[model samples]
Target: MFLILFFFTGFTIIAFISFLDDIYSLPSRYRLIFQFCGILLLLCQVYYSSPYSYWLFFFLSILSVGIVNAYNFMDGINGITGIYSLILIICLSYVNNFITTFIEEDFIITIILSVSVFLFFNFRKKAICFGGDVGSVGIAFLLVFFTGQLINTTYDWKYLFFFSIYGLDTIYTILFRLSKKQNIFEAHKLHFFQILVYQTGFSHLQVAAGYAISQLLLNIWIINYSASNPLFYLPILFLLVIMHFIRKKQGLAITIK
Candidate 1:
């Protein structure tokens, strides 16, 4: 009961501030500060419940913050946020039902339903609305909380594969920006999905559906075969190489322009 309260309270703080940012254009620093505070509150519940090592706590804190920001950064197009989040949440729901049962089934269902509603409006060729920072950040925080709990319960880090797609895109974009001497913190449309939409002439729905499908396939593999082999990351590595080639080809095109 207390854990649920902690989770919701922390989520409320992050979501409320994110909502404000959507409306008021709050400074980045203030958003970051509150984000950390919110994550800290969620982690506090974990700390008191199981008392893991300080190192683990520190790592989870950093990871949680990164994921929250990554999720927010990835929310740049129609249907991508709603679609990707719905797929990921559905994957988590599978884990809850068949794997480890860390969170409530009803809780996951409610989220699925909410994302479905958002998709009805946002998944069209001309989106009626967007997830915005509040929607993206809120769902990201909730997933982080759920993922953290599952990892804690099972003591398996492989579950992180659930976030592989977004994590890959975020890391690659940051590195690509750094190589060009650009500030990664600034807003730009360098993400692979963005590139597909703006540069490759793909429709927003097409790009969004591509991402969701890729993640769905990846999640299926992770849930089935990853536990048996250590080389599960080979596919992820292959994906990285593909992304590199695409970006390289596109990077040259941008240069020629």
Candidate 2:
């Protein structure tokens, strides 16, 4: 409980600072510095003696920072971060139920519900506020922590595959941009979600709703499959393709943006 509180405090601090930074127009370099500090602090608290070695721990620390930033990048539209956060939390919840080891359901459930409440307000049209970079970093930190714990105990390397949607989209989009000689890290409205909103004229809420529902259904199917099955994953790919077309027809493909 104390450590969970620490997570909230750390992220909330980041979010608060980000709020100021957003309003005051702080230097991008300063904000990056703060984000790196927060990540280092969070990493310091995470010690793993479970099943992995120092090398894995070191790798995860670096990966968590990258993921934290990647999520911040994806925060180009409303509901994207919150929706993704909620999906991951729910996935962790289901993961808690089926897996015998490293149960942290209470903390994970609390975080999910808390974020869901936050999303209800933020994911709306003409939102009160965008979830600034701090919101992005904070949630990413939480997910990384949980993910590490899950992989540590379950020893399931394939669990990472569950993040395929976000993983593939962000990575591919970056590569595509780079191939075209574009700055991969810079802010641009080229992501799938952004394209969907701008080109399709789809209501922001509707697009977010689509992603949320799709993620919900996908996670449900994965949970039903009981980690033993690899074959079920193929069908998920088909669904991904179908969803892409639906968005494309609706003028929502991320690539089009």
Candidate 3:
């Protein structure tokens, strides 16, 4: 009961502040400070965990806060963030049972699933709140912590591959932008999803589906690879080509030098 109360309090406070920030156009630095504070409070809630768990959640808290911002920066279109969160939550629920964690497994899944449903409505066409820094960061923080718990229990680093799609997009987009001497932080349409949205003439739903589908396919492959021949995992390029083909058909692929 206390633990649920702890998470609910933390989530409510963060969401409310984030809602305010979205409407009032809060300053970035202020958002960062709030993110840090939120992360701190969240850490305090789980401080009673073991030394290793404590350290893991601590690392995850900091990183989750950053990822919250990362996802926030990238979420310019409709349905994207909600879809992304949904995918992560579903995957976590499916994967968590396989790995043991001190955190109540079903509770984490229930909370996130509930959050995603509510956020979906809030984010659809008319966003009540833009997920602001709070929503993005909180989701990121929680997901990463969940991932950490899984990693700690399973001890299988291959699970990291599940997040490879996001890492690829975010890292590649940043480097690609930086190479052109552009401000990587500034809003730009260089992201593959953005390209599909603007260049390919894909609807927001289509573009969001593309990303979710690609990642889902990769995760499916991960599940299969774990059971059968690891050798089948080769030819990632083939999969990339298919991904590009589908995105291009929708109108988003650009010729890269």
Candidate 2: Cα lDDT at 162 = 54
Tens digit of per-residue lDDT, candidate 1, span 24-91: 98998999899988998998875666757889888888899999999999998889988998998999
Question: Which one wins on lDDT?
Answer: 1
* Stretches of candidate 3 exceeding 4 Å from the true structure: 1-17, 40-62, 98-105, 112-116, 119-133, 224-257
Give the clashing residue pairs of candidate 3, or none.
68-136, 68-137, 196-252, 200-251, 200-252
Residue 163 lDDT (model 2): 59
Mark the 10 consecutive residues where model 2 has the least summed lDDT: 248-257
The TM-score measured for candidate 3 stands at 0.70
Question: Which pairs of residues collide in candidate 1?
Answer: none
TM-score of each: 0.94, 0.76, 0.70
Q: Which ten residues in a row have the lowest lDDT in candidate 3?
A: 248-257
Q: How many residue pairs collide in each prediction? A: 0, 2, 5
Better structure of 2 and 3 per lDDT: 2
Query: Which residue pairs in model 2 clash with each other?
Result: 192-254, 196-252
List the global CA lDDT of all models.
Answer: 0.86, 0.68, 0.64
State which candidate has the highest TM-score: 1
